[model samples]
Target chain A: MSAADAIAVAGVTKVFGSGNGQVAAVDDITVSIRKNEFFTLLGPSGCGKTTLLRLIAGFEFPTSGAIWLDGADVSDTPPFRRPINTVFQNYALFPHMTVEENIGFGLKMLNRPKAEIAERVAAMLKLVRMEALAGRRTNQISGGQQQRVALARALAPAPKVLLLDEPLSALDYKLRKEMQIELKRLQAETGITFIFVTHDQEEALTMSDRIAVMAAGRILQVGSPREVYDAPADRFVAGFIGESNLLPGTVERVSGGLASVTLSVGGRIEAVAPDGFSGGGPATVVLRPEHARLMPAAGAPEGAIAGTLATAVYFGTDTHYHVRLADGSDFTVREQNRPSVEARFHAGDAVAAVVEPRAARLLRERP
Target chain B: MARPFDVRRQRGFTVVAAFCFALLYLPIVVLVTYAFNAGESIANWEGVSLRWFVAAAGNAQVIDASIRSLQIATAAALIATTAATLAALATTRTAPYRGQAATFAALNLPLMVPEIVTAVALLIVFARIKMATGYTGLGYLIAAHTAFCIPFAYLPIRARLDGMDLNLERAAADLYATPVRAFRHVTLPLLWPGILAGFMLAFVISLDDVVITEFVKSGGQETLPTYMLGQLRRVITPEMNAISTAFLALSIVVVTVFFLVSRKRD
Candidate 1:
């Protein structure tokens, strides 16, 4: 554990049920979330992101692991004793309390002076810009406003770390977008380490300083949004983070975090060997549509892969060319529509797909 | 915007609903109306007066029974509600344990069992306890009523706990509130309507209990319902109707207050 790490989850595993019914909700996972950094646990439903967050919050006990908060082992500490707070997915604000009271509840629990609580609550209201409606009951407020109150309530305690469990999942699209930036601003202003759990890839990419993409109760990769999106760690991360054209290939050799792979269509391509890549086996090359472009097959570059154009889709600002390679695997190439360029090719035209250098990577496949 | 199969719009719906309403309320209406009869007999339609109400109020036996019923109901409602709240929290808050369903079934068994059967069972159990302890004060009735009213109270309290968002308490704990504090601030306030509803149900159940009181009571220990049952065997008078009307009004007031309080909370 590093001194700058706000939370260190070491081999944390949370299992539920017993006997024949036993299942690990959170498999053995080790991660270090930095202090003052907005870290996100991104995954689909039942992927154990929420369970992991709950473990760090002390709401759950890891079956056989230690959780360190600020260099102190707090694995056995109860939630109330931990210096962490959570903004629940449903905002779980006290329905009977006014917004001010809800925000002040933590301070009251901490036995802060009445005046100090009032002052802190007022500041929180102003931080969330809910001062005008501090006296309103939580149920009386709109969903967006309730979200703000939840944020304010969680922030009011000035906890060492704030855990947000898909807090934006309940908001409408426009409000969700707005809160994305709002949440980023709050994280920056507070300068507190925020551990956010979200299933929305776009939301995680937009707000997180670093993100841990999770699947099947394990962290697949932990990096900045750009790293995860640009160079995924495995097949699941590549397929889950964004759209990718997965072409079946075989790894000829691997060295220096790069893999030399021979495509099924009798062409050779270079791919970034993400973590979990095993040597000398069949693999799938992840090529983002934007990383490749289509050209006329006649007199095309020698390194370009040859294919037949299957379909072309217009998407206002870009056009997607779906190409069927000789191996029957489809590759999609996206190009921005420039006014100076002409219509490239229609459906069923022979085309050459050119992949940008160091833009594609093959990952180890589970047979 | 109309529904395709609105039950209220079905053929003969109004007639059927009215018939059911009459079947339920017409007898109560006649009883309340006759409570003001001037004549001694309840069978005849006499001039309207409050003579029976005054007579029932002045009668020492009726007064004693009324006070006894109120005491038992109040004590039982309070004890049952507290126990129900604890049981509700235990059942709903924790992870599902072995025998959880069995515990729920046992808690609600009184609601499923016939009242007379429970009365007889309680009579047998209490008879042994009374003989061994040599105690036959109001404690026996209160304890019996408390036992019978538990399920009446548990159902509403448990239903409320089920409907509540468990995350509210979790959020409290996350906010540094201890478990007890969480219950006080988050769970209890949200559960007020359910608690009040449970208390009312238990109170009403205990207040009018006749079979259990009749089966278990020692000499000179008559509740209002047992006293009324005893009166029915000898003679028929409008005083019974007067007492029933008063009891009905009190119940209506309790229910109305509950409704208003719950509505205002919302």
Candidate 2:
């Protein structure tokens, strides 16, 4: 591990139960989280993201492999001995304690002087904008206030790393959005390495400096938000990150760092193939909805695929057109709502979907 | 709003409730009243006086039995509550394992089985131990009472642990509290009411227990209830009534304090 690495999980595997009933909650996984970076583990429920966070928090021990924190092996270290803290999904604020007491608990456990603990708790409560509620018990506060208290309590000790497990999942949409910005601001201010776990793709994209997209006990790909969203590693990652139009095709020709694929829908399209492509092999062309443009069939570009607009969904900011091609495959193309009336397309309208070669990716088909 | 039931039906319900209360408490009221009887006979109360109460208080055997009962109850309650708390934490906090159902059943066996059977079984075990070691004292009573009260203490504690959010304990650990410290600060504080309730229940149960105390006690280690039973077998007197009234008063105070402590807070 590098000096810059805050947490390094190497070949960690956590299995629950035993014998025939044993199931691997976190399969063998390795990832190094850098210091002072907002890293996220993103996946759907049962995808082992939370389990990975728990393993790092030392609430769980791996079946095998080591967890390194700040270049020290802490695989067998108890949670209290580790220089890490967690903001639980439900906040889990101590109902019996005042917010100030909750935030100061760690410092007290560490045997800090009473004066220093009081000062630190005051600073933490101020950081989370929970100064007014500091004297109140957790149950007396609102959910959002309790969330702030949980964050304050976890961050008060200024641990080397902070782990958040879907901490915003309980909030309403508006509050979640507000806290997202607040959390990012806090991370920037604190400069503590954050390892956030969540299933929400938007949350991961909005907050993470780097993301590891996991599914079924394995990390599919580790990259920045834009990298995973634009160039996913596989069909699963492609479908998971965001909306995409995956057109099944056969590679017709490979030239100039790009591959021309003969669409199953009786058309030809070009896509940038990072890996050298072989002619006549089955491939999937990942076309993001926003990358495709809807045009009139009569004056459409020569390489554009033709289809009938099956449905038009108005989403205020953009209009999503579900188009059915000649070969029965469907693709959704999102068009921004223009001021002009002619830019809109009705259902059953003849349309051609145009995708730029550089905006599309050609990936090998997985069996 | 129109009435859903007739006034007669409502009055009939009230009458039934009053009858049940009378059946439950009238005998106790009479006993308490007779404790203050000025006369020697319990049945013939000449006037209300504190003579019997004073006599019962001054009686050396009564005082000794009461002190012995208090000692046994306190010791048993402490032992039972401690064991119950540990058992509760084990059952509720840990991941489920094989034999968990069996463990639960075993913990509750004392409550489910007839008291006479447990009393007899304990007597046999204690007798065997006495025959081997030739040691007999209030230790056997304390042991028997603790065993019987374990379920009483375990139930409330387990319920509290079950209702608790496990995440709070996890959060405490995450905040750098060792397992012991986490229990001290978070789990124990949240479970305080339940623990207090369990202790009080066990104390009351141990204090009033007759069959178990009777079977388990050595010759000179008669607890208050066992001594009262012995007196009743010989003859009924206003002194017995006075002692019973005092026991009842003590129980009521404990139960009332328990309810106050365990009442829900905002």
Which ranges in model 1 have alpha carbons more than 4 Å from their true place?
Answer: A250-261, A272-284, A339-343, A362-367, B1-3, B6-11
Candidate 2 per-residue lDDT, tens place, A278-337, comes to 556888888899998888899997778899999998888888899999988788999888
- The whole-model lDDT of each prediction reads 0.91, 0.90
Which CAPRI category fits model 1? high
- Colliding pairs, model 1: none
Quote the positional error of residue A73 for candidate 1 in Å.
0.6
Which lDDT tens digits does candidate 1 get at residues B1-266? 86798899889999999999999999999999999999988879879999999999999999999999999999999999999999998999998899999999999888889989988898899889989999989888888899989999999999999999888888999988898889888889889999999999999999988888998888899999999999999998999999999999999999999999999987
> DockQ scores for all the models shown?
0.84, 0.75
lDDT per residue for candidate 2 within B1-266, as digits (tens), equals: 87686765774788888899999999999999999999989899699899888999899999999999999999999999999999999999998988999999999988989999998999899999999999887788889999999999999999988999989888888888888999999999899998998999899999999988877888889888888888988878899989999888888898887788677532
- lDDT at residue B111 of model 1 (Cα atoms): 84
Interface RMSD of each: 0.7, 1.1
Instruction: Kindly list the per-residue Cα lDDT of model 1 for residues A1-367, writing each as its tens digit.
Output: 9999999999999999889988899999999999999999999999999999999998889998899999999999999999998999999988888999999999999999999999999999999999999999887899999999999999998999999999999999999999999999999999999999999999999899999999989999999999999978778998899889887778889888788888888567788886655568787888999998788999778768889999899888999888888978788899999886766899889899888888997765555
